[model samples]
Target: MPYLLLIFVVLFYAGNILTGKAMNDLPPFTIAFFRLLVAFIFLLPIGIKSAWKARNTFREYKGPFLIMTLTGVTFFNTFIYGALQFTTASNVSVLETVIPVVTVVLSALIVKEKLPLIKWTGVALSFLGAVWVVMDGRLLELFSSSWNVGDVIMIGAISCWAIYSIVVKQYMHLFPAYGVLLVMTGMSVLILLPFVAVEWTIGSVPSLGEVKYWIGFLYLGVFPSVIALVFYNRAVERLGASQASVFLNFLPVVTMIGAYVWLGETIKLPEIAGAFIVIAGVILTTRAGTRKKRKSLNYKKTSYN
Candidate 1:
């Protein structure tokens, strides 16, 4: 069932790609705000009790919690919705998989995490693959083709994801996943409110009366925002983040099929090849590492002092 849950996590993540495509008319900030607000409303009942019980958790780890919530819940989706305004879902999925590479590189520089030669090689390969996809497989396009705003925006989103993942690993012990999610969801809603207000002023926010927009909004609010988090927390509990992320390699493939089916997106060979290359690099980076005893990341350490 762990394997199945991993697949479910990927599916729900793929749903985000579809959701973004479906809400093309809505302002990115508006969509992001609504998605978080709806998800926060639903998730509060499930996790708020834990958060209340652990109310001091916030006081203790205020800095980390603030940073985590801002990066993961706030800025990440902000850029994702922004990116969808200009690029294809296939490109988004393929590019987003580079999160690990971004994390690894950042860790190395920020925290001085050392990487073996093989992992370094993987990093290089993954970057090249990302460039290949961004340029539609031809390096010459780097010079000839104008860069897509969506692609550039997605890099910002991916960077936020990377930072969030690192912060989670460092401080996940402070609260249960549910409790942590509750806090983050609330923070995201609050942080996004001002932006939503601005979008409303600009008249870019879409009306909620449209059925298609409701479907897209509801799906994102529920599936990716709520369901994916539960499944991912469970997977991380069973398989450590490094092992769990291997399953994320299937993300692009799933997104490709989902994009084709839901968004009527056409896949290109270069995009496919680039995705494969990126996944291959990820596998090399993660799989080549030294082995350790099987220890689940229960992350139940008491709140920090």
Candidate 2:
């Protein structure tokens, strides 16, 4: 059942890529601002009650909350949307599979969490696969070929997400999940508002009259922002973060299929092979982490008894 919910989560996230590409006419900041604004509005009614109940938690953890909102809500999708402007959706999706691996690395560096040898191996594999895809399998042309700016931007996107994931794992359990998300989304909307105004001054404002743009915004706001996140939080509670994130290995597959079917984008050999490698690496890394966690739990239980 948790797996089923996670599947839907990835599906919704994949739709984010499709819709982001389709809505490329809109400025990235504009899309991010309004999409989050819509989500904030949609979540306000339910989240408000829980938020009030947990007001003390919010007040106590303002720093963590601010970090969560800035990295996860504000910067993540905006980076994705910005990357979408310069890269193929398939490329972006493939690169995004690096998140779990990157998160593990960050966990080790920032939190001083020790990674097992197998986990490090998995990280190396994932990194290699990501670079392979970015280079379009032409590793021989390493220094000579021009890289896609959007693909480079994806690195920042993944880094923001990696930081966000760590913060969530460390602190999100202290607050009501939906309530926290509501506050975060609202914060993101506010943070992006000034940027959107600046963007408008540069003639990057979206056309408000287009039905298609609204449809895209609705999909982005409702599915990826709200529903996927809600379902993902539940899945994480049920399955544990490592186990649940293992399912994201399929995200690239879903996105690539959507890209081919909807946008008529071609999936090249390098991308397919690199995606396979990345999936393998993510599975290895996440499974290794989960096993380590289980071992630690058993050790504590033994010591307690």
Candidate 3:
């Protein structure tokens, strides 16, 4: 059942790319702000009382919440939207597959989690696959010309997400999930206000009258922000973070298929091969970590006995 929820989670997230790419005409920051506004509104009725009661708790742990808001809510989707402006959504999703490997490295660096060598090799494989996708299967072209700015921006996006994941693992379990999301969404809306205002002032405004744009807006706000988050949290509770994250390896595959069918984006040979490699690497990395964790837990149980 948790795995089923996770499949939906990946699907909803893939929908984010498809919808966001479709509405690339809107200013990226503007899109982000509105998306958060919609999510805030949707979550308010359900989470407001809880959030109000936990206001002091949030303030007490303002540092982590602030970081979470900035990294996960504010800039991550903004970067994805911005990247879509310069590259295909498929490329964006492919690059995002590196997040798990990056998160593993960050885990080791920041939390001092000791990983075995095989996991490090998985990291290397994932990077190689990501590079292959980024260069569009033309490895030699990397030397001749600069990579797409969109791809570079995706690095920021993934880094923000990886950091956000680590922080959540470290601190967020103490808070009510929905309430925390509400507060963080509210925070993101405020943090993004200035940039959105700038976009408005500069006349990069969204077409408020367009039905398609509104559909995209609501889709982003509801699916990825609310529903997927709820389901993903539940899945994590059931499956554990590492196990749940392994499902994300399917993200690129889903996004590519969606991009092709919905947006008529070409599914090239390199993308296919690269996505396979990245998924293989991520599975290896995450499974290794999970196995090691299980071993440690077993060792602790033995000592206790």
Candidate 4:
């Protein structure tokens, strides 16, 4: 289980780095549209089978399914890719480490999941750590020239993903992950079609000759979109949402390493410190939830007796 989670982290991080690199050769929307289009194509058969077996359940979950598709597949991917065009991979990576914190808060509000004080404190610390990394510790200079439009877009992307995570946990009991993911990807592709058309009309289609771009696209579609989704849903099924979320802390670390290896980007001290703080905060928050769950179980048993 731990090894699978680690693979998920590595693949997702690689996906983000590939996404960042793709931005140099292809427009963000184009990449976002096609990556999902490919995912839809690839997963269509599985979705059909799941829907065939559980048609009634599919109808019942239509709303949540649409919401997940729109937020997770369409909005999240578009914003992240777009942000990559305007920001450094490091900035995008560091900013994204806050998703776990956002996921926890959203889960509490949406599903009435009880969070402990330690988790709340951890969320705060992790958030500050992400902000520190983004600001490079100059705190007050956050909105200065140092900040780019990409940073804002990435923040929005992170929020979308956080919401997606919460919604997935809330609805997983009502629908199978394969069905949910397929529907989400299908809807995202549909939503992106018009934009893709516009870009095509403008002659913005990516060149097939660019081997690197194709490799990135293939990696994004296969590992990050499809394989990662499977692993993530499985983890969520086994561990529950809050516990599963801890895996997200490794995203920036993997991304940083990928950037250094592939893009030859330098690793700075601030990024390392920020990553550590973020990981610590995630651990604290996750453990807090574990403690709360034990207490609740105990209370239930006592009340029943």
In TM-score terms, candidate 1 sits at 0.82
- CA error at residue 168 for candidate 4, angstroms: 1.0
lDDT of 4 by residue, 92-134 (tens): 7767767777777777777787766776788777766666665
lDDT of 2 by residue, 126-147 (tens): 6667657656788787567566
Writing each residue's lDDT as its tens digit, candidate 3 over 1-305 gives 77689889889999998899888988899889999999999999989888888888898899988897888888999999999999987678767877767777777788675667887777667666766765678877757866699989999998998887777766777678789889889888988999988989988566689888888889999999888877877766654444455566677777777867886778888977977886777677767766877998999999999
Query: 33 in model 2: Cα distance from truth in Å?
Result: 1.1
Candidate 3: 10-residue stretch with minimal lDDT: 237-246
Two-way TM-score contest, 2 vs 3, winner: 3
Listed in order, each prediction's TM-score against the native is 0.82, 0.85, 0.86, 0.84
- Identify the candidate with maximal TM-score: 3
Sort by lDDT, best first: what order?
3, 2, 1, 4
Name the runs in model 4 displaced over 4 angstroms.
2-7, 45-47, 134-140, 143-146, 237-247, 294-305
Clashes of 4: 0
For model 4, name the residue pairs that clash. none
What CA root-mean-square deviation does each model show from the true structure? 5.6, 3.1, 2.9, 3.1
**Candidates' C-alpha lDDT:** 0.74, 0.80, 0.80, 0.72
Using TM-score as the measure, what is the rank order of every candidate, best first?
3, 2, 4, 1
